[model samples]
Target: MHRLILSLLIASLAACSHTPSVPLYRQLGGPDGIQDIVGRTLTRVAQHPTAGRTFKGVKMPFLVDSVSKYVCKVADGPCVYEGENMVRAHADLGLQGSEFDVMVSVLREELDRAGVGDAAKNELLRRLAPSRRDMVQR
Candidate 1:
């Protein structure tokens, strides 16, 4: 009886370990997915008059490179995000909470349109939600 109980406990523990966390990179289809989403997002944001204006005089390529790198790193892909700190990056931009919220919402929509699975979406959002805390000016 003691041996049976120990075996059952071990089996349960092993099952739990394989239960699976949503992978940040794989669900988005890895590197290709990230690039696709980036393109769609840039188009969405660019179409918005306000956001389009915000990009004026800003180094667009640099910004996109930074975004790609950041996403790649977060997704556990083989890339380094050599961008400035989140707080410093947007410090002078004077981003508003509402604006950030709109951007995030738009991003979510793009991800869905790209057929990103719910698990991946939830996991990615879980990872990025904290950024809003620092992005919005008090």
Candidate 2:
């Protein structure tokens, strides 16, 4: 009886250890949710004095779609990003740290407006934070 109980305890512990947590994509409400967040963020970015200049002459629809894909993929969603890599994409923009900071602030605002929880927002931002190196040329 003692051996059997020990085996059962070990099995229970193993199962608990293997349980999978929800992915960030699903936590953010999947594709539709990500799309909504991106749309609102872009609208804010377009109105931002510093960030808006970077978007001039850019096609809004394509930009939106690409951003949606990129965010979705980064969040571990089912979508794959087909856009240009960050380095190549932002290479000619001559972006500054201030501009990137402004964009991130706008993104946080949009995420909050979309009802994203702090944990989810932080996770998403953490995933995106690495791109700053590529985006900030100045």
Candidate 3:
């Protein structure tokens, strides 16, 4: 009986180990949720006194689509990001740290508005944190 119980425990542990948690993309409500977050974030950035100037004369629909695709890919969704790499994309922008911070703040606000939980938000932020180096020149 003791041996049988031990085998059962091992089997349970193995099963637990094999269980896969849902990806963050699905946690953030998939494509629709990502689109909503991106839309709100872009709107806020465009309205921001400092950030707005950077977007002047930019093609907003293309920007929106690219950003949405990037976010979706980063979150492990099915979408693919075909846009330029971060360093290449923002290289000419000469973004300042403060401007980057403002953008992040706006994104955070939109995420919260989308009802994203702390765990998911933190996870997403962690994934995006590396892009800061590419985005900020000053």
Stronger candidate by TM-score (2 vs 3)? 3
Prediction 1 TM-score vs. true: 0.78
The TM-score obtained by model 3 is 0.88
**Measured by C-alpha RMSD in angstroms, how accurate is candidate 2?**
2.5
**lDDT values for all models:** 0.77, 0.89, 0.90
Model 3 over residues 1-138: C-alpha lDDT tens digits? Answer: 999999999999999999599899988989888988998899889889987878888888899889998999999999988999999998888899999888888888888889999899989989998999989999
Give per-model TM-scores: 0.78, 0.86, 0.88
Pairs of residues clashing in candidate 2: none
User: Model 3: runs farther than 4 Å from truth?
Assistant: 2-20
lDDT of 2 by residue, 17-128 (tens): 9959889988787998888888888877887877789888888888888999899999989998887999999999999999899889989988888888899999999989
Q: Which of candidates 1 and 2 is the stronger one according to lDDT? A: 2
Which runs in model 1 stand beyond 4 Å of their true positions?
Answer: 1-22
Tell me which of candidates 2 and 3 scores higher on lDDT.
Answer: 3
Identify the candidate with maximal TM-score: 3
Residue 87 in model 3: shift from native, Å?
0.9
